[model samples]
Target: MTEASMRFEEGEGFARRMDAEDPLRSFREEFLFPQSPQGEPLVYLAGNSLGLQPRRAQQYVQEEMEDWARLGVEGHFHARRPWLPYHENLTGQTARLVGALPLEVVVMNTLSVNLHLMMVSFYRPTRERFKILIEGGAFPSDQYAVASQARFHGFDPKDAVLKLEPRAGEDTLRTEDILETLERHGSEIALVLLGNVNYLTGQAFDMKALTQAAHARGCRVGFDLAHGAGNLRLSLHDDGPDFAVWCSYKYLNGGPGALGGVFIHERHARAEGLPRFEGWWGNDKAIRFQMGPDFVPLPGAEGWQLSNPPIFQLAALRASMELFDRATMPSLRGKGDRLTGYLEFLLDRLPSGFVRITTPRDVKARGSQLSLRFSKDPRRLLTRLSEAGVCCDFRSPDIIRAAPAPLYNSFQDVYRFVKVLESHARD
Candidate 1:
């Protein structure tokens, strides 16, 4: 059968046929999935949360452990991956994933730590222009980081933070309203900080437009790309945000609490005058061993480093990064759009008022996620999925976020997931 003819149809039979034709279907076997009572792999749709671990991660991690056991201190230089410059090896692939220049990206601390560090450098607040403009209902970690940053700079979170909420009776922020808010409050704002993708609503912002607007208003801009990076084909370099940070654990498929990534625009990559928290590891590489009590920072984003990177975490991440290197964002995204569109199509067939799809219907404005908003308690439905061996996440109040990641998830996985969802509605 023609591959095109096999794509995008309703029901289990067609789903199986489409899966048979998917070029990326084998990628799913590379990761381990949760099992059911019969010891069968469950239908997983929760790549938006913590992603499944890559089977290759074990081999990569074992190499580091063997080096540690045999060479002790010498492993720093002798190890296969070489701990001293481990992070450098990841630069090329990571840069390609986010579409940034190699010098502009670095793998560092966890998501929140990277966010605070970026804030320290770019969120320079003045008495007149001290406020931060962000969307309301941002991930709680971000809200806390911005508030503390305001307090540390001697401003009240109340007066120093401005939130842009959806219009009355709305579920997400509108881009026009964001532009208007910037126009009205632009002069008083020092920084425009926002999540590249709203975690709860799954709304992807027009980052290029937002960056241009903020730059016009004389504000430094940055993005928390924890939800956006591996999911979207972003052009961070061309988009021109001053800085951006993201975690590798979600769609990047690194293990939990895996290292995060940071990107500083080449324009500010080596700005000597930029204010940043100093650390010994960030000192110039040539004189790093000299350690002469004075600090001369590295030329680019690596200058933000605080210490030698954790080699174990970097190794675990390398396994999945290599997979991403093979699949490539464009190929994965092509399959992703249709896989998610099929999920949306089936959900639309749900009985009236059973749920609402909160993520943008316009595919350009969202990634793989579709936030299902149910009037009935979402946890109740979650309990049902849990018993039946479906792997999806439930958020507070009412959101069940199902993401069929293109790299590993198949059309039949989406079909089976919806079939179970339909069964619950009938009950």
Candidate 2:
């Protein structure tokens, strides 16, 4: 293309035009963006880290506050969206977002906590085959939770945790290499836990193939959907993993520290009794108030709950889930690919080694986030990006993660981010 045509294609005006034509453009008004001290939008793009708060989040929280003031404890049953069946309202929508039946999903505790709870029931380890196989660069919280679970089960983490690192001198793990490791260690691996989309590099693993391979080896499998829940197209039920866990605080837009969700395959929901860490909430809903010592576990994913649900967090989550219901994951995934591709195109136009995209280039192999590795000091580039109001995330050592969430982020956001990044590179 001629210089004139190239300039026309990448100009700020072009970004504005793209935003104008965007189907999700109206959704941007739904979020409460962070502001500078001067009170302007901070150009927020870190939705993969923690999504922007939905405007309705305050109303959801206030509804509970009002209920507490008016109905007191009776609000559990009397409040609008009664706290008694509050989680039920979210279950169907949450399941739909991840492409599962209502019976397969539950919205409850925080992410790491839910992972441990699921492990309690699913990670049934024996003396001969008791190790957990996981990706090498897992989120620290996940590593900590898995290690703690191993210790809780009387196994040493150093011996029971089998980490799969990338091949030498590579940033991302190859799919073949991961499958080979699973095949080689299949017999001894009691559980195979991995991230659907890696938090750092944005590499999305193929869940269906991986789950099938793990199951063939007689190993239980689970996924941390923290980065993939709303950012990628996931059919949890069809994928057929033993279990999964994710936090709504990220792509689900449920505000900071929002309630996390868990999924249990339908097969296990009715299978002969299994061991689980239980609480009164896990008891049968019909006789929960009967206060019997006998714990009759509910039939599905709800059977895993361990305590009274967090009403306030659930409220915010409900608000966010409603938004996700209106915007489905498949549609979001389509836009995510284009936005990230635009980012890659822009980054590629820069001078050699100014920035390198560590995230996989295959659209099918990544979510919305792109990890930018800088030739200059990463911290310095981070400061420059911040000063320019292009909000993003930084992983230690050297990576900037910018996620353009289709729910609220526009193509214009991606264009602006690249403009700032290119300017910084030149500086």
Candidate 3:
């Protein structure tokens, strides 16, 4: 049902009815949830930070362990699924997941590593245009990576890096402001890198418009899809960003520390002069074993690989991607919008002045996450939530983030979470 037509009501029975009518309800059983000391299932709403483990992950990982035990060295070529080309198995699903052609996507190193690799090629700064543009409150790791990149290029970060901040009294950036900034500083910007979805406010940016604006200014554009990958319906090829990167651990439901994926537009698939840090795994398959001194990079995103990927990580991610492939992005995104909308509706019913939602109220402008900003210190409330078996997370200062992941979260879960908030309001 569309969000506008979906009627919401107060009471536990309404939540149960919504769950009963949900088309995706059965998918909930696919994951394993954590339990409280009393053997009750914890209300898990932290999928934005780390997704719950898929039940199939263990089975997929166990299969690889068996192959390693049975075939030893020969497992590279002879074992089921094989070891040498294990990363290849994830390519098609990875591509489909992010709306890119298979040649444009590759599953490889962790997020920050892939970001640096993409910068090696896309962030080609010159004497005239040598600045990088990013959000002011980007995840700390991104801040460090871009700043270090500026220093490596012999420019002072304080001068070379430009951070975009929201207008006074606002909690999120406006699309018009972002476009205007790009137009004003277009000449000086060598690269425009942004998180497609802000990790803090859960604001989804207009990547298509941002990419067009940056490209018009002769600047290379990239996105960290760390929060956007599975949470949003992305069309990287259509959006026309030079490159993008994301970790599989969140939303994609891969286990913690799982490998990340990268996307390089097909235009750069075989660009001969593009600068990249080459390694053995990125070498063209035909002559890779020749042990030649010269690096012959493979075509497309695979050309960016630095080494053979970790097999166990790939196997675990493969299991989760399989579910995503079956569920499809369109279906998941539709349900996600509804789930988050329902969460917003329920949260609005809490006592006035109890807490404020920092996430944009526009359903299309956010994913399943909502950031709750409170007037008082929230650490004690967070402790109380844990004690009550609620599984949301607290950011520093006064914000708490709760993500009702549609893949597994039920309407009842949202209802129950708000009930706890109502209790806190009374207290």
Candidate 4:
């Protein structure tokens, strides 16, 4: 059916029909869904926060653990999937997920750590072009990271960090305003660092346009793709962003606090003296064990690795990346668009004046999440919904964020969640 003819009827029948027709419906069975007291799967719409664990996750971790116990030291090379090159296995899949070449991507430290490392290389500043431009209300961790980087470079956060804010009475930032800001201050701005998908508003920025505009003004650019990496179809390399960093836990389904992925555009891959913090793992694999005094860095993003990663974390991530490889990002994204559109259709029809969606109306401008702004406290409403077996999450004073993740969520799940919210609005 055409999107315009996709009229949503007021019943479970339409939802069921949509699910029955979905091509990716079987993918839901691959995950371990959490259940309420009645042993039924709750309407899980919080994959934006923590994805449901993949069924194969435990098995993958156990293989590594068993190898560690049996072979001990020899496991580094003798394990079922040898530990020395375990992270290398994830490089290609992760690169595919973020739309970059394998050489430009690497699985490494947590999100913020990678952000700081990227900043070390991309955020180089001079006395004139040292200002950092970023979106206002960025994730707190990113704000902290930018500020600390500025301070470490002998600049005050107040003077060095430039935050782009929304206009009064606006819920989200406008693209034109972003470009204008880049154009207006491009000469003095040393770096442009913004969240590709804003966590609070679910806004997906036009990274290509932003990157091109920044490059035009001689400013280096990067992105925090925490919410964009798996949630949206990205071309991090082709889009010409200098660097990008993201966590795999949210949309990548890599379990809580999983390893993050980084992209250092191939343009910076060489040994042409790019300044970065290095350790043993960042050294060239050929001479890494020789314990030489010289630090011979590896090519591309691997040169940024500080130490070997935690094995269990990589194992949990491997299980999910394998699933993504089979399902494919384009297919998952197709489903995500329809699933979120269904949620938006239902929410728009509600008679309640108590809340409004803060997420953008244009589907292309957002991701899988829909952020709702309530006139009153949304926490109580969220609590009541949870009691009724819903699993969406509440953010701060009034926003409730629901994400109908394409990999596992179904149309029926969206219907059930809205039904609960409609009931609360009536009360």
TM-score of each: 0.97, 0.96, 0.98, 0.98
Q: Enumerate clash totals for all models, in the order shown.
A: 0, 0, 0, 0
Best by lDDT: 3
Better of 1 and 3 by TM-score: 3
- TM-score-sorted candidate list, best first: 3, 4, 1, 2
- Residue-level lDDT of model 2, residues 1-427, one tens digit each, is 2111233256778778877876767878988888854477877889998998888988999999999899999998899879888889898798889989899999888999999888988898899889999888999998998898889889999999999898888889998988998889899899999999999989999999999999999999999999988888889899999999999889998878888989999998976678898889988999999999999989889989989888899888888888888877777777677677766777788888888888988888988888888878789888887887778999888888889888888777778788877787777
Runs in model 1 lying further than 4 Å from the true structure: 1-7
* Location of the lowest summed lDDT over 10 successive residues in candidate 4: 1-10
Question: What digit string (tens of lDDT, one per residue) describes model 1 on residues 128-214?
Answer: 899999889898999999999999999999999999999998888999999999999999999999999999999999999999999
Please write out the lDDT profile of model 3 over residues 324-348, one tens digit for every residue: 8888988888888877888888888
Kindly list the per-residue Cα lDDT of model 4 for residues 1-427, writing each as its tens digit: 5333466676899999999999889989999989976689888888899999999999999999999999998999999999999999999899899999999999999999999999988888888988999988899999999999999999999999999999999989999999999889998899999999999999999999999999999999999999998899999989999999999999889999999999999999995777898889999999998999999889999998999989999999999999898889888887888888888888888776877999998878988999998775588898888887889878888889999999999999999898988888877
What residue runs in model 4 are displaced by over 4 Å at the alpha carbon? 1-5
Question: On a 0 to 1 TM-score scale, where does candidate 4 land against the true structure?
Answer: 0.98
Which consecutive 10 residues in model 2 have the weakest lDDT in total?
Answer: 1-10
Which residue pairs in candidate 3 collide? none
Ranking by lDDT: 3, 4, 1, 2
| Candidate 4 deviation (Cα RMSD) | 1.2
User: After aligning candidate 2 to the native by TM-score, how far in Å is the CA of 403 from where it should be?
Assistant: 0.7
Off by over 4 Å in 2: 1-8
> Model 3: what TM-score?
0.98
